[model samples]
Target: MTATRTSSLRIAVAQLNPVVGDIAGNLAKARAARKEAAGQGADLVLFTELFIAGYPPEDLILKPAFVKACEEAVDALVADTADGGPAIAIGTPLKRSSGLHNGLVVADAGERLAERFKIDLPNYGEFDEKRVFQAGPEIQGPVGVRGVRIGFPICEDIWGDLGICETLAESGAEILLVPNGSPYYRGKVDIRQQVVVRQVVESGLPILYANQLGGQDELVFDGASFALQADRSLAFQAPQFEEGLFLTVWERNGEEWRCVEAPVGAIPQAEEADYSACMLGLRDYVDKNGFRDVVLGLSGGIDSAICAALAVDALGADRVRTLMMPYRYTSKDSLRDAEDCARALGIRHDTVAIAEPVEGFTEALSRLFAGTETGVTEENLQSRARGTILMAVSNKFGSMVVTTGNKSEMSVGYATLYGDMNGGFNPIKDLYKMQVYALSRWRNAHLPKGALGPLGEVIPRNIIDKAPSAELRPDQTDQDSLPPYPVLDDILECLVEGEMGVDEIVARGHDRELVHRIEHLLYIAEYKRRQAAPGVKITRKNFGRDRRYPITNRFRDRS
Candidate 1:
């Protein structure tokens, strides 16, 4: 391949959301994006990895029919380019004589120009690509389009030590274009920038990174797509958690290709980004799963309140239904707070008393528990009753139940198994208790721009001001059984995310006994975590896909 000196080139980055297995819908999106890019005078348009089949299509590629459907979708898009529109470099899975491969196909003017397979297939930590996709045989050279030689590396190809970028550069590639389905974790944007900068510095060529934007099950792609010049300077940046077609201009200066400066969209960080990720994840899950409405028990506690707010923000107030399941242990203040929150959010609020069901269960189990004392088992009855009621409503109304257990509670097994933990999905499963409080405060301070809820404080101040409790028994609070949220969250973070030993955690100003107890709880709770509903992953190591542990393990980190 020889590098051709082209004067100018315009590339449109389609950072759009795609639904898994929705081949026809995804094809329509691709066609519309190409038409828009053509109108903007773009020379080419780049889409994220596996846009047709959606990212992490998981086991769907194994089905011959599914793979055939994806190929048909790609063919349809290729046929649409006969009108002399901008060329397309889109991601799709291809079935070849060798094996199935995660591939990128370039199409222009009713002709397929080049097909490049992903060189690296990631298999660890939320990715199982190696199980499905076969790695490309060898490093291929760049493809020339309109006098410019461009290299296409699918997601994970450039993240390894395979020297894909270096190989392309050595083959006279002028620019590197990477299509990614990179999921959003905390501070992932910085990590991506660093990765791209390293590749650019090594290849001495401008790199454009286009990432998918949407929530696919437990994964949320932030789509903070950006371009880096060879000098490590940013050329353009698309906003995170948004779906759009952004145009970037490139011009040849002397012998090098450089991206022209364009509008750089503002990107949120820290809590704002985490909140946005949760919103997008929930919204996409609800929308993509074809649920018309969602139901959650708003207990006037911080976790449930914040989840309700998120539900309304993701799916508008009209689509959310809050049920307050009050029992003998439920306080007057909680009922009032729940009502206030529902009123502020403009959602329907109803009260379903659990006393009858609780008593009914107690009566049924009285003979079996003749000698047993009424203790934790009885308290769990209240929870199970509430869970059953919520499930009944979900079944009757055809709405999904949203569980509301935070990371701290989940880490220590503080949540009941089939009781408070019974739901289809959880919006805040990855958030720690402290993070939940902070997000609630931040939400009260300012409504996110795309939030569907009202402008004022949707989560009442009293809810944030009150003590955190499950309210399963008389005067019971969360601290009655566990440590303070701040201390517990810090210790769990060290244990779960940091993977620090007991001594190391205690050295960080925590008591030795407390650290050991928390560590024990964290380890024992793996069974429960394994059974919990899937939620958005906002941190580096969430319970579900990011961190995997054996439920029957006996080894403990005594050190």
Candidate 2:
């Protein structure tokens, strides 16, 4: 007679986006997700790591009372799960006899089923996990769930080649479930899929991976949670760059478990993902912090135009406003393009000509400077005037000002500090200049997430086609100061992100002198980046708290 398998489990992955330090609010979101999963006949609801307290609580996990409160919240959640429909596997930091362990508390019917701690602690890049929490020793046996043994690995444990999954498989574990609070940068989604598929193949057990989705300060989490079969095929995918919940069905085979077919949600492209990440981060930062709307200077350049479209998409037309601060050097095409982009987004727009203030500033500085040649100093004055006008509008109308400088500009001190950089938040500071142009074209062609403005050509095609300029001086195109965007972005990636030396960059067939100039500018601009507004990070080495190069360091390696 053939052996038969009878048991099946329905698991719901809650791709929840939680705010830092908001325990009560996070708990509320978790409970609501659990309830929804239960209503859909799910046996278990799996949430991302530290769902109770939020991911990478950093030093907050070192506070004893905060950890205790999180444990209490976990207990309360366990009690809430006793409603008899669905069990919950949730991550939280726990204070134990040994030390503080990054852990997950599993509950079924008001009783604790298992407590799994994270074994591997990542200590590089944006993570300082090894600093605060103690690593878990090792699991002796698999967690028993519904008469079937299951393995539960916390976030970083399943990332590597060796660890819990192999041990659990050797000890009769039938399935694996992993939870994560992974932050978003470019190329992270592919890395996540590779790791999950590796675990499934290694353990010969189907895997369920859940991840958090939201913006917390400098970091943004993209929710592209997925499930994989024992054969390493993708079973289902949750939505990316949003909060969602979906159920995945798993059935028992001879001794292993396998997943059934489920609909995979839409997967956005690189440009779309970057755009949505910015919009989501901006929307959350503004709305969660209690700002009702945003205001910004609408230059005809691609950066501000794309930023305006993002603002309108994130907060709707009523919540976004634009002011064009035209100086004597401002061009007619610029005026037309700014108005066209704002009008296309259905946002309130007005021109506040700064000719008087420009004249006044020039007069004031003329007496002070006396004999200094009129150069970048005078050009920056115009930018400062526009910044002042935008800030004044923000102060009067209670709207936050959104700065619109891209990463390329921010990298090379090309942006004037306290001038065009004045704002409460920046939407595209992490995006490169070429990326800004691409996203501008993409937005003109497609409707962005939660877009409330008119559909077609919100950003005029001319804006996309125009030569990029600051218009601070007569005929001052970006190319006059920096190299073309494609070349500049490549050199910047090599220097800033790759940490490539001068020779390595020169090896890429770039002009050696130009590369050196970019490097100097990047290092010199550290001071300005320190003062810029917080924006979503879409690259490996964003110029925020993530990359910390000193402004006064003199250790240039020219060899």
Index of the highest-lDDT prediction = 1
Which regions of candidate 1 are displaced past 4 Å? 1-5
List runs of model 2 lying over 4 Å from the truth: 1-6
State how far residue 313 of model 2 sits from its true place (Å).
Answer: 1.0
Give the CA lDDT, 0 to 100, for residue 442 in model 2: 85
Report the error of model 1 at residue 138, Å: 1.0
For model 1, state the Cα shift of residue 40 in Å: 0.9
- The number of the candidate with the highest TM-score is 1
Error of 2 at 405 (Å): 0.5
Report RMSD for candidate 1. Answer: 1.4
TM-score of each: 0.98, 0.96
User: What's the C-alpha lDDT at position 342 in model 1?
Assistant: 95
